[model samples]
Target: MAEQNRTSVAELVLEGLSERAEVKAALFVLLLLIYTLTLLGNMGIIVVIWGDPQLHTSMYFFLGSLSMVDICFSSVTAPRTLVNFLLERKTISFTGCMGQAFFYTVFVTTGCFLLAVMAYDWYVAICNPLLYSSVMTHRLCIWLVVGSYIGGVLNSIIQVTFIIRLPFRSSNVINHFFCDVPLLLALSCASTYINSMILFSMAGVIELSTISTILISYIFICFAMLRIRSSEGRQKAFSTCVSHLTAVTMLRRTTIFIYLRPSSSYSPNTDKVVSIFYTLVIPMLNPLIYSLRNQEVKSALRRTAERITVRL
Candidate 1:
């Protein structure tokens, strides 16, 4: 009976970001612009990092991996969102919804781990400059990235497996633009205590572990910077870390707000607004944040542009 009920709901309707016609139209245009910029900005970073020998370091490798993840992460929902804005009935099939949730979890979790890895990279670079080259080798960088994806895939499989087994009997209307675990949990017919516990525990573990890594890395970095007697040296070390700190704060706060709590406390409207920032806006902002603050990236971009102009 539970299995039958679970399979009964073939499709689910999404409430999306807005209901009013004018709002939808405006958001459609706005999201389109943001999505375009996200692709261009992230892709531009990847290309610049790849083409420039100056950026052939562990730091830039991680940055390139992050750009690729942002592209995948945003793509999980952005196109469907744009399409839904045109359609009267915003619906997703059960398979599609689960798939979206699964991939979204995978990419987002991977991104969190990657950020932690990058934080560790910064720690090594700033705290142990002499050993940075030896510590963060190309092989080690590749393994770290692969491990992040592995962790993401494992978490996603567990979470989505439990979610897919849930019997969503009646309510097929999800209260957000995309399929999220909390919203989906609310739609299930059976008691979601186990599911909620699993969600909170899994999310908590990821958040706690990653954030702890970042915090500890920064703490060591701070100590290392303090030992440097020169103000200029301290400032240079701080500059390297500030951009990553900004991104971590932005992403961690929203994710903790959404996932590390009970589903009963979820505010649909608030979640939707926050989701927009992380999902659509953050990807667009990451490259800008990194590139604008980074002189090396700026130099690379300038050189790349000059080369392109010469070719043209």
Candidate 2:
């Protein structure tokens, strides 16, 4: 009976952003444009950092890692979504949905932790300038990046395990654009009390702690900047952190809203809009956020362009 209940729904119908033919076409075109730009923007950052020897620092290294994450994390869902928008019958196999859920969880978790690590790096650079070189060694940065990935995968595995075990019944229509924890939990016929407890309690704690660390680091950074006597010196000090500050604010706002809440409170309509922001809009905007206001990145891009022209 238990096994029968689980196999009842093998493929899920994705009720995406719209149902009208005209709306689907518009959405497809718009998303395609955004997705193309997202790829170019993020890959452009990675390539620029790689080609420019001047950017071979702990800060740029982390930035490059972040670009990679944005690219990959966006890729996991965007392509499938684009495909579904065009298809008459929007369906994903159970296995594919599970895989999507897992990867989505992993990349999102990794991105959050990476932001926290970057915050710590900024704190070290600003607050402890003299010790920055000694503390944020190349070895340590690599470990931090690697550890974030490992931690994300581990967390995804645990969460996906809990979710996959729950028996989904006759209701196979996922109201959102993609398969996510909240939507999946809503679909499950089995008792999701334990799942809700873990998601709200465990996930909430992690998000809260990460945000607290970021806040504390920025507090110390503000104090450090205030200590600078010269206006020029203070501005210079603050410039180094502005891009990161913006990125953190954008990522944390949508993430905290989506994850740190009770399952019962999750309205599919509101959650889907938030999902589009973090998964699609944020990834598209991240590279622009980092590069547009950044002089170093602008200079590196110019140098990279000159080198490419020379090669041509």
Candidate 3:
């Protein structure tokens, strides 16, 4: 820990949140409940999907991937933030902040890529129905997942590199709950033009491009829906897209709100509010948005329950 910071610094003090005893206790309770909810919701999605062999298709496979990502994404910040809220000192050392930023970078980037892949999967399924099975076969699905991981790694490397190289000279009170890219960069005494450029470029490629792909895919889906003669098919198709649309909306809104500015011009207060949405609320909502309204998931759960009851 000491080795990570400058040699002149003797002790790394954590400058956390307020000193009010009541406020700290309240925050701890609220955040602890949210954190628990996040874990249960995401893990439940993964468990149900894995347990239901009927969900072994590409769609559910990606859904399981999404659930895993949500779990990791929320876990990266919420637990630590909850701990910080409970403790008297909320401050994280230089290394700890950097490490948090690093994992956050990885999971966040993975989410961006994963959403794009899911969009592509839907595009293939709807746009080319005859070839859907062949196109989205096990091999292709594996490749898409691999692409997501690769994109996440590459993006995280870029963001972390810029953040790591910057010099932070005192007044290290990060207004937010966690060590986000912009908040950390704001502490740098030196100019952050290089870092800002890298952050913007990375955000542009990963966030913007992925979102655009989702919109375009949905546009085509909409067109196809208009042409469907069967009412049942239309309703089912629309329902399939509704979940994807909801998830995409949540991800994109929070992402754009947070990363749409240069670090030099970012507001920590705005960042903190939006960060809570994406980092905490959004992860908790993923399973509900995707699984709650889906009849297949509900049916599978019932079947599993009866099977367990009979065995017992």
Candidate with top TM-score is: 1
lDDT of 1 at 92: 99
- Shift of residue 94 alpha carbon in model 2, Å: 0.6
TM-score, predicted candidate 2 vs. hidden true structure = 0.96
Q: Rank the candidates by TM-score, best first.
A: 1, 2, 3
Model 1 error, position 14 (Å): 0.8
Candidate 2 regions off by >4 Å? Answer: 1-7
Please write out the lDDT profile of model 1 over residues 58-98, one tens digit for every residue.
99999999999999999999999999999999999999999
**Residue 309 lDDT, candidate 2, scale 0-100:** 98
Which of the numbered candidates is closest to the native, going by highest lDDT? 1
Q: Write the per-residue lDDT of candidate 2 for residues 175-250, one digit (tens) a residue.
A: 9888887778888888988988887775777687778889999999999998989998787667767888888899
TM-score of each: 0.97, 0.96, 0.91
Give the poorly placed runs of model 1, Cα more than 4 Å off: none
Residue-level lDDT of model 3, residues 1-312, one tens digit each, is 542453222223444444678877886786678778888988877888888899888988998898898888889888887777667666677777777888888888888888888888877777788988988999888888888888887877788777766656566666777887776777777688888788878888887688888888888888878888999888877888888888888888878778875445566556666777888888888888887668888787788778889999
How many pairs of residues in model 1 come into backbone collision? 0
Ranking by lDDT: 1, 2, 3
User: Lowest summed-lDDT stretch of 10 residues in model 3?
Assistant: 6-15
